[model samples]
Target: MSYSKQKNKIRLNLVIALIVISLFSISAGAKTLTDLADRKLSLPDKIERIVAIGPGALRMVVYLEAENMVVGVEEFEKRNQQRPYIIAHPELTKLPVIGPQFGGDAELIAAQNPDLIISSYLSQAEMNNLQAKTSIPVISINDGSPGSMTEAELKMALKFLAEILNKNDRAEELINIFDQHKNELKSRTSNLDLGMNVYIGGIGNKGAQGITSTEANYPPFEYLGLNNIIEDDKKSNFTISKERLLLENPELIFIDQGGIELVEQDLKREEFKYLKAYQENEIYQLLPYNHYTTNFATMLANSYFIAETLYPEAFKMLEAKEKANQIYKQFVGQPVYSEMAEIFGGFKKMKLN
Candidate 1:
């Protein structure tokens, strides 16, 4: 071979080696993350398409302003129009359905061609099975209990999701907003003992129930340091018998609008009309915060309304609708208060006839 030809051949081999190295680097571009389920997953460095499965999974994505990257949604999410998040982003309903509620159909999820699958409230084994079936990275997240606005678990979940979606700034901003609301609520009602007996009824458990459905340690009541009639060691939701409710006989009764119809029907009974709240017309309605899971923003807004209602002089300047609109806008990028109010009668005193 000529000397110049030999030199050209060596240069060509060197260029070929560099090309191979570049390809290898591209194939290995992934980051390991520990999800809320404590599963270690290697995900692509830049994830452009994702599908959220289970309750509150898609809401986290929407919270981070990464909804645009969602490729598909659960059938339940598409059908449930009552949630504030869905009301704000109706386009999500237009996305292809991955499957039914809770966990999605693996085949349908894989068909979406998503780079990542976000699973909430799924066990590790379920997540592993999903990932294995779809050949996609699955990250499980927990959003704490439904209707809790200030739980640490929720904050951590948001941070973890924000990290994966490159939305750290948004996560911090949201966290700050939540903290501000918490502080404001605490400050507003920290002092002054009204010694008022309160009860929140018509809470949704598996689904909507009548006026007997109630939550122990209800978040809004706890936030404002109000005295809840139902006391339990563990925060929970359950139904109380009409006799048990009469025994407690709380001074003020707040109904969750989700089950307002059922509650209204219950009030028609002669037995319920004997309650102190019924006779004094101290019943009111609060926007429902639990749909698929907790709508943190709505829950927070409820606290303000409750405070304003119980201690009007303290919150005299706080306009309930305006404050609710601000909170909804911050969380979902839309002023959804009007829509929510339209669907579930806005904050108002209930007239038991």
Candidate 2:
């Protein structure tokens, strides 16, 4: 072979080798994340822009103080202003709408050009399908149901998302605050044997319902060791019949402000006046904690208010509204208790004539 030809062949081989190394480097840069669905995903090392889909997904992102990274949101989030996270970060609503609700529109999500997509309560197949459709790395985290999510499950989700967003310190801070509040609540009322039967009505399931709508095992009652009139093994929201409510006849009644108006309308009937709670004027109003999904911070605030109401001596030092604002600030980066109170009536007693 001619000397010039041999040199050209060597140059070509070097160029090919360099291309292979570059390809390997690019592959090595990606990190593998094992999502809650138990699916393995190769995500970009630096995820700058993201989109959160499904119920409680965006809320979790906001909890981790990573809302700035979100480039788009579900259409419902823009329309609904009840959620504390959304209320705290109104700018999120201004972002591009990805889709209507629940799972987002794949084409719209793709158009946002996000580096990653975070989802909640989605099955493995669904996450895989979304990733395939959008050609974006998708990670699923389980946030269980609102008001029913275990603390461990919530912490796991927060830590996972925090790790992904490089907000580990924030995760720790949140977890600690949650623990402190839970412990304080338990300690306050653990020994109290509140024999009086209590009931919370006007609980919103899908939309607002009347006084018949309630939770079988209300979390605030469980936290405060108060006796909830309704008892079931399954901790879920369901409507009870008026006849059954009359039979149970709780001594103390608490109405969820979400359905307070409906509850008040129901009270106009003389039959409701026969109940012990009505006769003694024991009915009180509580802020709605189940807006959108679980307003976890609001739930905690509700627990404080419930405790203060049931055993005033136990919580004499505590100011319910002030405590609520502090909790709202810790969870959502803003004190949203006043805004929430204004939307749904603030904590107070119901006037039953």
What is the lDDT of every predicted structure here? 0.83, 0.83
RMSD of each: 14.3, 14.7
Per-residue C-alpha lDDT of model 1 across residues 1-353, encoded as one tens digit per residue: 34795688467545533432332222366777666665666888879999998878888898899999999999998777888888999999999999998889999999999999998877778888989999999987763234433355567677778777889799879977987887778778778687879999998766787998888878788778876798775667778888999999989999999899999999999989989999999999999977666778888888888888998888899888889999999999999999999999888898778
Candidate 2 lands at a TM-score of 0.87
Residue 127 local lDDT, model 1: 84
lDDT of 2 by residue, 1-353 (tens): 34795688467545533432332223477767666666767888899999999877898899999999999999999988788899999999999999977779899999999999998767677778989999999887673334444445666677777777888799879977986887788888888888898999998877788998988767788778776788777767888999999999999999989898899999999999999999999999998876655667888899999988988999999999999999989999999888988888788989876
Question: What ranges in model 1 sit over 4 Å off?
Answer: 1-28, 143-150
Residue pairs with colliding backbones in model 1 are none
List TM-score per model, in order.
0.89, 0.87
On a 0 to 100 scale, what is the lDDT of residue 278 in model 1?
93
Which lDDT value does model 2 have at 286?
A: 91
> Which candidate tops TM-score?
1
